[model samples]
Structures are given as structure tokens and as C-alpha cells.
Target: MKLYDVIVAGATGMVGRKMIQVLEERKFPVGKLFPMASSHSVGKRVVFNGKEWTVQELNEENIKNSHAKIALFSAGASVSRHFAPICAKYDITVIDNSSAWRMDPSIPLVVPEVNREKIFSGSKIIANPNCSTIQMVVVLKPLHDKYKIKRVVVSTYQSVTGAGQKGHDQLMKEWNEEEIQEMKFPHQISFNAIPHIDEFLDNGYTKEEMKMINETKKIMGDNSIQVSPTCVRIPTIGGHCESVNIEFEKPFELSDVREILSKAPGVVVQDKPLEKIYPMPIWAHDKDEAFVGRIRRDETVKNGLNLWIVSDNIRKGAATNAVQIAEEFIKGK
Candidate 1:
């Protein structure tokens, strides 16, 4: 077995730290771990594979000298935009968690279960889809294959972690009734839900909502598939939950839908309405699989189905998904 040197950008941040943890949890063939971050976060220590690794500055000198084959980037879009090409220049495969390269026609917005084949050896930079989009597509792919999906309507009750550390801190501050200093959210997040995730666009839909709409089509490889999304940030530290209503082109039975999702990779069917069972963020936390429940026909629309999708945003949505893409690369080898 050959071990590979890996670089984790933004090592001190929430997603970056989780990337390190997932790499170890999955027991990736990692020989040397290079944890990189901004100047402020440098010298911070991250434990990987039970070893303490110091965070280094993400400068050209360090990136060029790291001798790493794969770089998992959870840094902001600005950082990814500036450094991802540099990693690609050094022949390092960059699986970016930011939206910097997701819409790029040349780059592949990847969800391994749906389109692992899009990735190839020469593919230098692969864009990991938005956390919300990743979980929804994982469940949608199997259903879309069985019955052609025409449109999708999704309302997300996302976790505070999706906004990074600041978001979590904001919720905690509100929960503790401390003095509110800086605002990560527009309003209080504790015991309240904000209908906004990212910046509001000219189209009245936020950047996060648009990401769901566009990303879903791209990952599913169907531009014709329509997606209407309203993303909300709720006070939760566990995971993200979505109320997904899917309309298929063909009629389908609930039994077949349940069977398809149960067998789908990275999907867990938790529907048991009679037993008072369904997916929830508390139960889905720290797990990689997308939990799907409340599987039933939407009586309002023809050929419609509704589902509740839940998954750990930090795990499957960010860290685990990026690691899975790296795993796909290793499998190709």
C-alpha cells in the first residue's frame, strides 16, 4: 500500500478541521499531512491520525514546497480563486469546497454517487457541490433515473455550521443571552429562523438559493430539470434538513421509491410514519449518509413525491464529500 502526502487548506476552520478528521476516519492512505491556513491561523495545531500537525501559512512558497498530491480546500472563495490554480499548476488535484469554480463550464461540479465518471486523471480542479445540493442530489439521482424528474421544490432548514464558525458563535451568543457584538446573521439565530443564507441577488433569490437551483441541474446532468429553492438558516448545530417536493415525468409508487433510495449509495431511508419515525438533524448529525424519510406522494400535484432529507453539513456536505471525491481518484488509480 502506498501512502500519499495530502494538503488541507484552511486547517483551523470548521470545515477544514473536519476534512482532516474525515481523512483519518476513512483511513485514507495519507503519508504526510500538510495543514495550511491564513497568517492568523498559522501555528495552530490540528490532530490528524492521532498526530499533531502545525498549521502553515498558505503562501506560494509553502504550497510549492509541500510535495502534496491532493489538496482539499475548505477556504473561502477568494482564497480558492487565488490558490486553486496554483495547486493545479503544481500537478496537485484540488477538490474545492467553495463556490469559486462550481459554475465553471470546464471544471466538474462533482457528487461522486451521481457523476463520479466526470472525474479523470487530468482533471486538476474538481468543485464539490454546495452542501445542501450534495444531499438533495444524492437522493434525487436514483429517483430521477427511475422516473424522469421534471421539477423540484426545496425548502431547507440549514444548520448554523454551514455559515462557518462565526455563525455557530452567533447562535451560542444568542442562546447564552450575551451581549450581541458583530452579527453573522442579519438577525438573531437562536430560537428563530432567518430566511436568508447568502447575499440577495438581483433576481430576489439569494446566492445560496441560486446555488441549489443551478447546482442541482449541473450535478444531475440535466439542464432541463427545474429547481425552486428557499434556503433558511435555523438555530441548529447538528445538520441540515430539507423539505423536498419532486415532480416526476412518469407516475411512480411509494414502495418503489422507498426501495430505490434504500439501495442508493450514500442514502439512508428512515421512513416509518406509523412508528413515528422520520429524518431529523439530531439523529443525522455526525453521519455521512443522507437520511431520507416522509416518503409519500404529494397529493396536490400529479406524479409528485415529497421527502425529508437530512445530513451532517460538516460531514457529508463538506468534509466527507470532498474526501469521497479524493477516494474516487484513488480508486481510478
Candidate 2:
């Protein structure tokens, strides 16, 4: 058996830590695991596959020293912009979980369930789509293939944990006491929903929202498919929930829609409203598949349908998705 050396950048952060867990859960062929982080976190230890691996400081010199075959980077865009290309230069295929190269035409923004074909052996760096966009596209792919989707309007109820541990800590601060504090978020995240994620662009849409709009088109492999998005941060944890309304070029029966999603890979349908069984963050936390429910027809438009999608933003959204891309690459061999 051939085991590949794997390096995880930002190994101490929220997404980075989960990436290690997913790697073990899926039983990836790892020869040596390099857990890399910033200088402040260099000595910390992370448990993976029942062994504690010490974190290494990430830098151009140390990075160039490795012979790792695959690198999963969850560091911010700056780190990715500087080191990802360097890692690729070492012939390491990078699966980056950041907004860095998602919009770059040269890089393939991949959602394994939706566009595994975009990832190839020669592909240097693969971009993971935004957390909100991923779950929506997983559900959208099957419907789009069947109904020929025309347009999609999505409103995301994102968990605070999506902002990383600091956002979660800030929310906890407010929850533990009545006193409020300014956070990485522009406004309070506990007991309130902020209508912003990332910087607000001149077009009145935040960078996060635009990522959803454009990344959806790229992953779906159709620029003609329009997407409108409103990304909001809530005090919830575990997962992100999206209310998506889609219009298709062809009409689809409600039962067929349910059947399609139920059978789709990495998607589960939980649409029994009378029994009060629908997708929720609490249930979706730590789960791998995207939970989709609240399926119905939109009476206002032709060939319109609505869906509620939920998934652990850290799991399927980042760590699991990146690992799946690597799996697809391996399977292609």
C-alpha cells in the first residue's frame, strides 16, 4: 500500500482541526502528517488517528523543505496567496479552503458532489467553495441536471463558528453575561443576526455574498444560471442553513424533486412537516451529508421550487469537502 504524506496548514484553527479529523475518519492513506500553524502555535499538539502530532511553524523556508505530496490549506488568503503557489511549486497539489483562488479562472472551484470532474491530476490547486454555496450546490446539482435551473435566490443562516473560534467565543461572552463587546463581526452576533460577512463591496453586497453568486455559477459550470444571495451571521453553531428558491427552465413535480434529492449523493431529504421533522442546525452538527428539507413548489413563478439546506460548515463545508476532492483525485487514478 502506498501512503501519501499530507500537510495541513493552519492546523490549530477551527477548520484546520476538523480537516485532520476528517482525514482520519475517511482513513486517508497518510504516511506522515505535518500539522502546520503560525509561530504562536508552533509548539501546540493536535491529536490525529490516536496520536498527538506537534504543530510546525509555516513559512516559505520550512514549507520548501518538505516532500509532502498533498497540502490542505485553511490559512487566510494572505497565507494561501504566498504559500499555496510555493507548495504547488514543490509538486504538491493544494486543496485550499479560502476565498483566495475560488474566483480565479485558472483554479478549479470544486464541490466534489457537484463537480468532481473539475479536479484532475494536473490540477495544482483546487479551491473549495464557500460554506453556504457548497450545501446549496450539492442539492442544486441534481435538480439542475434534471430541471435545468434558470435562477436561484439563497438566504443563508450561517453559524457563528463559521467565523472561526473567535466568533464563537465572542458569542459566548455575550451569552454568559448581559454586557456586549465588539467582535471580529461589525456588530453583535449573540441574539442578533448580522447582515454581513466579509467586507461590504461597493455594489452593496458583501464579499461573502458575491462569492456565493459567482462561485455557484463556476461550480455548476454554467454562467447563465443566475444566483442571488444574502449571507447573514447568526448566534447558532454546528451548521449553516439556507433557504433557497430556485426557478428552472423545465417544470418538476414535487415528488420528483424530493426523490431526486433523496437519491442524490451527499444529500438527505427530511421533509415531513406535519411530524415536525425538517433540517435543523442541532441535528446537522457533526453530520457529514447535507440535510435538505422544507421542499415545496413556489406558486409565484413558473417551475419554481424551494428547499432548506443544512450542513456542518466545518465538516462538509471545509474539511470534509477538501478531503473529498483529494479522494476524487485518488479515485481518478
Candidate 3:
């Protein structure tokens, strides 16, 4: 077996740390792991594959010196915007978990289960879609293939972990009745829900919401499919859950819907209303598969179906997805 030298940018971040863990859990063929972060995080220790690795500073010189073949970036958009091109210039395939490159015409916004073929061996920069978008699209892809989706309405109850460790720390501090040292969110998150995820756009949709709307079209490979999303940050740590209502061009039976989703890749059907079982974040945390439940019909609209989707925001939504893209690249190679 051949191992590849892998660099994980933003190694100290929530998603970055999860990336390392996922790599180990999935037994990715990593020969040398270069965990790179900012200067302040330099020399920090991170455990990967049962071994502690010192974090390296992310700079032009460090990146150029590492000679890594693949770079998984969970750094901020600005960091990714600056460093991803450099990695590409070095012939390193970059799978980025940031909004900086998702909308770029050249960069492939990939959900391996949805459109793995979009990523070819020569593809340099691959963008991981927003956390909410990833779980939803994994469920949407198969249904759209059979029913031909027309539009989708999604309302997300996202976990604070999606915001990063600061968001998680803030929630813990507030729950402990401690002084609020820093605010990662606009308001208090304990027992509260904020209908805002990212910066509000001029059109009233947030950057997070728009990412879902547009990225859905791109990943599903359909411009005609419309998406209306309302992303909210709630006080939870398990995962992010979404209430997705989809309108299809053709009619479908509930049994067929259930069977199709059960057979879909990267999706798990947990819909059993009478038995009082459904998909929830508590069960989704740490899991890679997207869980779908609460399957029913939206009688008001023509050929409308409703679904509840849940998945760990950090795992499947960011780290696992990025790693899957890298897996696809290696398979093609």
C-alpha cells in the first residue's frame, strides 16, 4: 500500500481536528501528516492515529517546504483564499472546507455521494459545501434523480459546533453560569435560537443560507431547482437537523420514496413515526451517514415531500466529506 503525505491546514480548529480524527478512523493512506496552523498554534500537539504530532505554522515557506501531495483546509475563507492557490501551484490537491471557493466556476463543490465524478485526478481545488447543505444534498440527490425536484424549502436547526470551538466553549460557559468572556454568536446561545448563521446579505438571506441555495443547484447539477433556506443556530452539540420540504416535477409514492432513500448511498432512513422513532442529532453525532426520517407528504403543494435530515456538522458535513473527495481523487489516480 502506498501512503500519501497529507497536510491539514487550520490544524487547531474544530473541523481541522475532526479531519485528523476522521483520517485515522477511516484508515486513509497517510504516509506523513503535516498539521499546519497559524504561528500562535505552532508546536501545539495533536493526536492522530494514536500518535502525537506537533502542529506546524502555515506560511508560504512551511507549505513550500512540506512537499505534501494533498492539503485538507478547514481554515477560514481568507486563509483558504490565500493558501489554496499556493497549494495548487505546488501540485497539491486541496479539499477546502470554506465558502471562499465553493462558488468559483473552476472549483468543484463536491458531495461525494451526490457528484463524485465532478472530481477528477487533475482537479486541484475542491470545495466542501456548507454543513447544512451537505446533509440535505446527500438525501436530495437520489430523490431528485427519480422524481426530478423542482424546488426545496429547508429550515435548519444547527448546532453551535458548526460555528467552531469558540461557539462550543461559549455554550458551555453560559450553561455553567460563568462570565461571558467572548461572544462567538450575536446573542446568548444557551436555551436560545438565533435565526442567523452568517452575515446577512442585502437580500435578507445570510451567507450561510445563500451557500445552501446556490450550492444545491451546483452540486445537484440543475439550475432550475430553486432552494429557499432559513438557517438557525440552536443550543445543541450532537449535530445539525433540517426540515426539508421538496417539490418534484413528477408524483411519487411514499413507499417508493422510503425504499429509494434506504438504498441511497451516504443516507440512512430512520422514519418510523408510529414506533416513535426518527432521526435526531443525539444519534447523528459522530456518525458519517446522513439520517433521514419524518417522511411524509406536503399536501398543500403538488408532488411535495417533507424530510427530516440530521448529521454531525463537523464529521460528515466538513471533515469526512473533504476526506471522501480526496479518496475519490486517489481512486481515480
Query: Model 3 — TM-score against the truth?
Result: 0.98
Q: lDDT (CA) for every model shown?
A: 0.94, 0.91, 0.93
TM-score: the better of candidates 1 and 2: 1
On residues 159-194, what C-alpha lDDT tens digit does candidate 2 reach at each position? 999999888888888888755545678877777999
Q: After superposition, how far is residue 69 of candidate 1 from its true place, in Å?
A: 0.2
Clashes of 1: 0
Cα-lDDT of candidate 2: 0.91
Off by over 4 Å in 2: 178-182
Residue 277 of model 2: what lDDT? 99
Cα deviation at 105, candidate 3, in Å, is 0.3
Write one digit per residue (lDDT tens) for candidate 1, span 165-268: 99999999888889877899998898898999999999999999999999998889999999999999999988999999999999999999999999999999
